[model samples]
Target: MLNHYPLWKYIILILVLLLGCLYAIPNLYGEDPAIQVTGTHGRMINEALLIQIKNALTHEAVQSKSIIWQSGEILVRFMNNELQLKAREIIQKVVGQNYIVALNLVPATPHWLSYFAAKPMKLGLDLRGGVHFLIEVDTDLMMDKIQKQNIETLHTYFNKKNMPYVAINTNDQNRIILRFRDESTCKIAYQSLSSYSPDIVIHKNAYNCLTVDISTDKVYKVREDAVKQNIHILRNRVTQLGLADTLVKRQGDNFIIVELPGIQDTARAKEILSATAMLEFRLVHLQSNIYNSIPNDFDIKETPEGQAVILDRKAILTGNHITNSVANMDEYNQPQVNISLDNIGGNIMATFTKSHIGKVIATLLIEYRDSGKKDARGHSLLEKHEEIINIASIQSPFSNSFRVSGINNIKEARQLSLLLRSGALTAPIRITEERIIGPSMAVQNIKKGLDACIWGLVSSIVFMVLRYKIFGLIATCALLANLVLIVSIMSILPGVTLTMPGIAGIVLTLVVAVDANILINERIKEELRNGRFAQQAIYVGYKEAFSSILDANITTLIKVVILYTVGSGSIQGFAITTAIGIATSMFTSMVGTRAMINLIYGRKRIDRLSI
Candidate 1:
């Protein structure tokens, strides 16, 4: 009974292996060239849309393997890349600009395996051919925007507190100036504002004004938060495009690196990633006098129909309050936008509409665009544009749900809706650098990596079998199990992308695993040579060799953890795959091999064993 395992242990081991094999089945199905379509606004990917897509494809005589909707996007799988390319152009025209149609490669997983949510390991940007964008956040512009918001907040706070002040404004030097009647009032205002806004530096000037500037620490904090928030928003936007494996992380203090895998449309990715779509609903004011001056609390804008309109500066509702929006047609067959608001936004709209029935309300779309120049400190120059997309009069009061008509066409309506659904960015982002990976290069890299893995595995197997004989064959079996378990774990786990470096890690893992088996085999042979019984040698060899195996694997695991924590993109992928492989090898070498050894040699006592 020296190396014997219980019946339950055998059952558990078998179950684990079976589960791993089951999960690994998806990887065998391969992938198909596909086109993904995502509606910009709130276009639903339901059966009706599927029928329309099918009809359009049939009309164009584009043959496809299957069409399925998943995660708010429609995927049309084709037999070959040629058909995929042809279908993309035809579908884009059929769907119009309201939807984003992009080229992709989707897993052709079987229905039985897919029912368990088993998916193949995602390929990284380098492996799947995608776009890489180095986006720089305009920290200077963020600081300015924060300062202006603070100035406005101060104005509101003073008005509410009945504090006497002549004017509150922001200067070119990023200082908020509060003009007061006298020094006594300025001193009081400084004390109050300083307490209210602790992050800002409040100073009483000689001109009876209080100058407020953000502290250095606060500025740095704001920039850091902006970059982090932009990363989160970019991830959400990318997911909305139906992309699976995307990398969005901070590259430096102000730059982000976005790796979108299997996305061939660089222009579309750039547009979606860099868009800052902010919406506002304001009361419109019509003026007859050409030279009429507008108040400080209002702005002048032009509608899409070439009509000039004046709107309030403060919005009754903004995109932040929008819960949902979709593009559809009105009763007269004209395109319109249907919007759903949150509770607070609903209340505000209801109150406004109740009081201002028959009054025109303007829907303003604010977007930020790069100015094609860098500023003095090497930050990108950005310009903000506010356009009135819709000007409609309220016929009745409503809450939560409402519709805006007068959209020029269905395409525009869809684009507006998509922007609303994607949400707005807190700050502007500009692509400082971009790179496209072609499909041919990706395929070649994958082939080379596969070749390396195959050769490494074969070499390991042949050496083990030739040297250790039967025991070597047992070790090889365990190694194969380790590989299967590693891939299965990665496939089952969400967000694990396999890259070329990751493949290298797998090869390295196989080398380490083989070394472990060799160590154990040599230890057993040494024990047998010392005149020990076969059972005793097997027990002693495994018990003693475990210490060395644990030490080696633990140290390597520590290094892998460091790499994972400090590295980015492909480096992280390598770390992840290596870590998982190390863990699986530990299980297979000690548990898996020991189980097989027990079944083979633990049944009866033996004086001599094959070495």
Candidate 2:
């Protein structure tokens, strides 16, 4: 009875190991180098498209493992990475611009195991081929834009206060220059605007002008906000694109690091990540004369056909308030964008449309792009481009839901919908550095890491068996079980990316496991030397060594927690696996070894132990 376990204890142990082995089996099946082809806009993958792809690959003399159409997408698995790359190029040329071809990795898990939701653990960009981008945010331009907005705010404020001014504009030096009618008016306006906020520096200048500039503190705050907001929006876009195991994090004050672990197409990732596009709804000034000067609070926008139209500068709704958007066809089979707004946006639209039911409303697309040229100050120049995407007369008062026509094709509609749904970036971002890891390079990294882990585990097992005899054998079994449990947990958990450093964690965990068993084995030997029988020594060894094991593992877990909280990218990946492995090692070293020891020695009386 000294080392005996209850029936339920054995049953629980057996169940846990069974489940661990069951889930761990998926990793052995490995993955396939595959290409995923999905239709763009409203294009749908059909039987005809599948046949077209098959013929293209055949003509290119590229051998494929299988080409199947599933879930409205075409998946072609190849025997190797070279063939997969070849097929992708051929298929892209065949499908034209209507479809998007992307490189992917699909699990070769059996159907029965997949039904149970078992999957292999995800590999990081180092172990898996993917793309990494170092993006820099244009915080200077963002500050400039903010200053222009402040100019508008000042215009409204002065109009309300009945203050007369010739013009309120931003100078080349990025200072707000407010020109007044006379010297007396300039002095009065400066006195009134200087006390507006502590964040602005307002002073009088020559020629009856007043200059306003943002304080240093305000500039820093705006830059911080711009970086944080861009990170959040980039995450939303990656999610909308349906990428898994991706990382988006801030590197410095104005840099963002994005790692797409399973995406190899840099063009698509860059296009989605760097796009600063938004939609604005403005009323078209149909009564204005094109030859005359533009009205106050109005601007001119050109359509695709080179026709200019006057539009209100003030927007009734922007894409920031859009809750959802979908690309679909109208009753006439024409492509259109269906949009939904939040409660506040819906209320604003309801109020605006009720009073002007017959007025023409225009959907304006505003984009800020890099001009590929820098100013004298070494800041990149940004070009603001506006286009009138849609023009329609409001037939009735509508709230929450509406549709926009005048889209050129389904592709345009889909792109607009994706941008609106994912929200807009607060500032422009440019990819400063880009690196692509091909599948072959990933395979090499995987081989090296796997070799390190395998060698470490084998060395640990051999050392334990040589020193402690049968007790060492029991520890070896527990160590193997610990490995299986670690793999199973990583597979089942979401967002666990295995990197090279993560594999190191696994090797370190095995050493910790061996150390734990050695402690117990030495404790048993000491107990036996103190005139104790085999059963009593075994029982006392486990009971006394538990506190030491728990203490050591607790300290390790504390360090792992700190690493995870403060680290990013590959450091976080390392922390994640180490934490999981530490936990699993504790379980296997204590409970698992004890259970096995009980089965072999707890059945009958023994005078001496195998050790």
Candidate 3:
């Protein structure tokens, strides 16, 4: 019976302890994998060399490769011998090709021993320590999109009614005013605009001249939609980046927030956020009016350097043609580009080059920083500037495509290709707000968290053993088993991270597991004193404890899950650890303690078990 036990309780205790031992074996005593490296010693690394090293070390051939920079060494960790050997091969490839020096095989320790020896997992920023950023989204681009949609609708209204326009000008702020040479034509254009601008209330002075104001409420709704869409696209881009445990969600009215832990570079974070995934292809229109190559009356645009600048009538070759692109060298030794086009973009390029073989079609490649730029002439050329690219050679089957020249370096070319592949965003994304956490803060927080957990766990264990004596010892055993299961899950499954709150949850769960055992032991003692036999008392105690166990654990489980679902950043640590602890506690308290009770009742000829 659970209320009283003799020698057999020791056997059940040994078996429970063995289960804990079983879980710990794989993590601690497992063999370390050795990978060989031929060249390159410990130091003297450059950016290009670092890229090659990282690529090699992170290659798929290695299993469970972990890269860490600490104590002036690049640490690599792996599990499989074969994968580690592959890492060696990768190291050989880089070291042999690039540098010459004696090699040292770096040593690595398994992360499981750090509270996760029973269950090992990688450390997150909240544990391992690094910067955490909460970046706010910008909604200016959304406003621009709404204005374009409105402008198009108004343009269609004029074109449909056969109204002639000298020109139409719209501002980035979404205001529209119709301009015409003749007063009568202007009046007619206004009539056409009036039909489409039903929500636009006209504010005119006593004169016939007019001003059309759009509904502010309608514009706000449109801006909200655009912001939501931009958020969606940014989410996709972040997903493509493949960061683990990254958090992204809409913040409210005008912004969304992205939380990236373990990301340290403040400038790099800004660059990633501002990167415009825009792709465009435009038909080159050389400013030939100055040199007599113009068609009819097209005027040439001049630059501040006293040279004629070309323009794109419209994009003819867009980034969509690029199926794949890489920054590699060409035959002539110039930093040129090679593009593999998709069917649509390829067909467009092929058709254009085939039609204009010898003629120099001036296509421009424009460099933008954060957003569109202004030209030296003070014109807003950010949205429309291009570097002039002339087609020199064409290559294709019948479909036809040409290679152009003008890239300066590998980094620039790669950036251009990636931007093109991502495509021009429908609009710009301004950084409305930014928050960055320094590494020193992250490390200090983790240390404080660990201190709290150590004290909480040690105190709980001492209390349990002191209060219930031998039964408390059994509860402690069950708690140990629970800890083992949780750690094994963390180490093997890889979804777990030992964040700060994760330690707190472990401590909290340890107390809960102890509570469950105490309830069962108290019930066993009550039944034995009420004249029930030892075996019957043990059975009834376990049976009565079942419902309470389920109810308490389930309620806590629900709360933990809710925290995981909505809470951001390390709040997720609380969720995962709480959930795992609840699950393991239920098993250790009800099932595990009962099994020990059964073993005791079967062996002893007593009327009571240990309390």
Q: Which is the leading candidate under lDDT?
A: 2
The parts of candidate 1 lying over 4 Å away from their true place are 43-62, 69-73, 146-218, 239-242, 274-276, 284-314, 317-363, 371-423, 604-607
Q: How far off is residue 422 in model 2, in Å?
A: 2.4
Model 2, range 111-132, lDDT digits (tens) per residue?
Answer: 8997889888999898888899
- Candidate 1's C-alpha lDDT? 0.84
lDDT of 3 by residue, 452-546 (tens): 76676677678877876767777777877887877655555555676777878887888888889878888878888898987787778888988
Q: Residue pairs in steric clash, candidate 2?
A: none
Regions of candidate 3 where Cα sits further than 4 Å from its true position: 1-125, 132-138, 141-167, 170-174, 180-187, 197-218, 283-313, 317-424, 490-503, 561-573, 596-602
List the candidate 2 regions with Cα displacement exceeding 4 Å. Answer: 40-43, 156-164, 197-199, 282-315, 323-344, 355-395, 400-418
What TM-score does structure 3 among the candidates reach? 0.64
lDDT for residue 353 in candidate 3, whole number 0-100: 66
Candidate closest to the true structure, highest TM-score:
2
Winner on lDDT between 2 and 3 is: 2
Candidate 2 total steric clashes = 0
TM-score of each: 0.77, 0.87, 0.64
**What is the number of backbone collisions in each predicted candidate, taken in the order shown?**
3, 0, 32
- RMSD, every candidate, angstroms: 5.8, 4.0, 10.2
Better of 1 and 3 by TM-score: 1
lDDT of 1 by residue, 359-469 (tens): 888888887777888888776677877778677778789789988876766766776776676666667777888899867788899899989988988998898888888
